[model samples]
Target: MKKVIIVGAVGGGATAASQLRYYDKEMEITVYDRDTTMSYAACGTPYVIGGVIEEESSIIMATPEQFQDKRNIDVLLEHEIIEIRRSQKQVLVRNLATGKEFTDSYDALILSPGGSAIMPEIDGMDGHVFSLRSYADMQAIQSFIAREKPSHCVVSGAGFIGLEMAENLSHLGLEVAIVHKSASILSILDEDLSKILQKELLSHGIDVYTDAVIDKINGNTLHLSNGKKLESDLVIMSIGLKPNTSLAEQAGLSIGVTGGIQTNDFMQTDDPFIYAIGDATENDDFITGDPKRVPLAVPAHRQAFIAARHITGNPIAKKGLLGTSILKVFDLDAAMTGLTETQIKEKGLLAKTVVHIGNSNAGYYPDHSKLTLKVHYNPETRQLLGAQCIGGKGVDKRIDVLATAIYGGLTIDDLQALELCYAPPFSSPKDPVNMIGYKAIE
Candidate 1:
């Protein structure tokens, strides 16, 4: 019987443990998490905060007891793995609740400590400020909102989390101001597309400040570098995430340029008997083949399968990542898959991009709506590289098709050739996706 131990039982770790148990029923498995709530969807935290999801417990997919009973996998909640002894093949773990320490030996180990919220040092920033990373963080933010009933919120950082927090806080009827040091937000979208999204945000009364800086925070007052001050009742930092790789670094594992654990297509680290997954590991870019960190839940869950299959002796290679993602803001929807024009330019890759606008449904239909679609392709080979879509409806479905097309090694010609179903209520005769493809060919 093989003994396996997994750390950080959230998206990646929990999924890996479940996969291993499914493949080898007799395998001895133990999963440890520093937090009590394990196997819950972290991505759904924003909706819960916004009252879009009413029940907090509904997000939890499985409990420790449930996993232990059904999967026969031992789950230790509120247990922290402090150290890994590579030579001894054992981990020194401390019970977070009791401060008691113990050792667990393993024939194989999976590392998935995930990422940490990067909170920069600003004057007077303390417990009063917040960043949502875990279930606890979400609960704290909710508690603060309920207790104080704050009317004004200053959310620093205009990235994914920042935007989501901004929208959710605004949905709660609070005036939200989004601040970013950059000239524009959403680095995933081109400047023109991002400008349109910015206007949509302005229509919702959400304040956006680009090319901005936070000078200091004194009590409830936030002073800006441009000599502006806001009476802020709440502050949320959504700057970015740093990969949790200190354990791997201490264990002498190799790190990548992206500051994540370096692993092969099999997810095997430099140490053959060990593996890493989730936000803690860097991924190979599908289009540019660059070392990239895609801190999304879907890729983490997929990596679990790849690691588990290889551990069970299948030795399957994983497909490189496209960093496919989507988000909702008020009445609008935005999604992106594959490389962006900005990234392609940075990599010195020649890409032909086409931006097209079309109605999602037949123009004459009552429910028809316009969507902006951008597709990127190799100028020479005409291979499909990436795509972005912004619209009220059908954005999600369109992004998924483009992601699949990229994965299938499809080209611009292939995209135009894709035979898609159409109805007066749902799609136009020339679907928005096909429109982009046809534009790419031109």
Candidate 2:
């Protein structure tokens, strides 16, 4: 029997384990994770903090027994891979609970050790400040909030997690101030599109400072480079994520320009016997075919499936990602798929973009919400490249459609004439997606 050892049994590793079992039941599969058993919806950690989710146990999707009994996969929880001996096809692991160490052999290896929150070298960062990266991270934050009961909070960084912490902290009735190094929130979005988000933040009474850098974070005070200091009760760092890649690197795996493990479409690393997937792998943008770091859940899960199939010799052809992502700020929903105009320009792609404001449903329909759709397409070929939507309702669906269109290599003409289900309460004769496609052609 072929022994396949998978490191880090979260989304990518866990999915890979199940997929491998489905393909070949007789294969020996062992999954290792430093954390607890198979957990799901780790991305929903923010919602859990905001009281949107009731319990931490709710996020867990599978237990070790379930994987063992159902899939015949051994899930070794709290077993961390400390060293990777690629030449020997073995890994040195340590049991966190007992402080015992051992080496495990594998015919095939899968690395999905995931990423961690960027903890900068600030002096007081370790003293106080939490990042909502893992289940334990969120638990610490939750305990801190409950124990400290801080009246005012400061969130550093305005990316997804930063903004999410900002909104959730504010919802907890705390005064929240966001200090961002970038010029605006959602720095990936175009300047104009970001302005819309800035206005929303202000409307929620959240103080947002752009072009601000934190020199040091002292007790309840953040020292800024702009000759200003802000006081808060607590500090939350949502700066960014650094891919967990030391294991692959020490094992002599090829690391990509993006500082992630280099992998092909099949998620196979330089060593065919070993594979890398999820946030740790260097992914390409389907539209531009350039190395991109898309650390979303869908991509992670998709990469796992791809890697599993390749290991089982049943590979599926995947064109890569369109960077599809969605976030909710209070009542507002923001989603984007494919490439943004900013990304298009960055990639030096000859692209044209159009923005239109439409109602989520019929104009006369009650509770109609405004939807702003931005579509980007190749000017020469009129091929859809990417899109972004911001609104209260139906934003997620529109982004989903755009994501599928980009995956299918659909053109603007195809998008414009596409048939979609519509109802008076749900959509219009011309869906926002088709309308954006029609406008992009103009």
Residue 8 in model 2: lDDT: 86
lDDT of 2 by residue, 299-415 (tens): 888888888888888888667677788887777888888877777777788887778799999989897899998888887898888888888899999889888887777887687
lDDT score for residue 31 of model 1: 95
- In model 2, the worst 10-residue window by lDDT is 123-132
Model 2 regions lying over 4 Å from their true place = none
lDDT of 2: 0.85
User: What is the alpha-carbon lDDT of model 1 when measured against the actual structure?
Assistant: 0.90
Which residue pairs collide in model 2, if any? none
Task: Give lDDT per model, in order.
Answer: 0.90, 0.85
- Of candidate 1, the 10-residue stretch with the lowest lDDT total is 433-442
Alpha-carbon RMSD of each model: 1.0, 1.4
Each candidate's TM vs. the true structure? 0.98, 0.97
Clashing pairs in 1: none
Count of backbone collisions within predicted model 2: 0
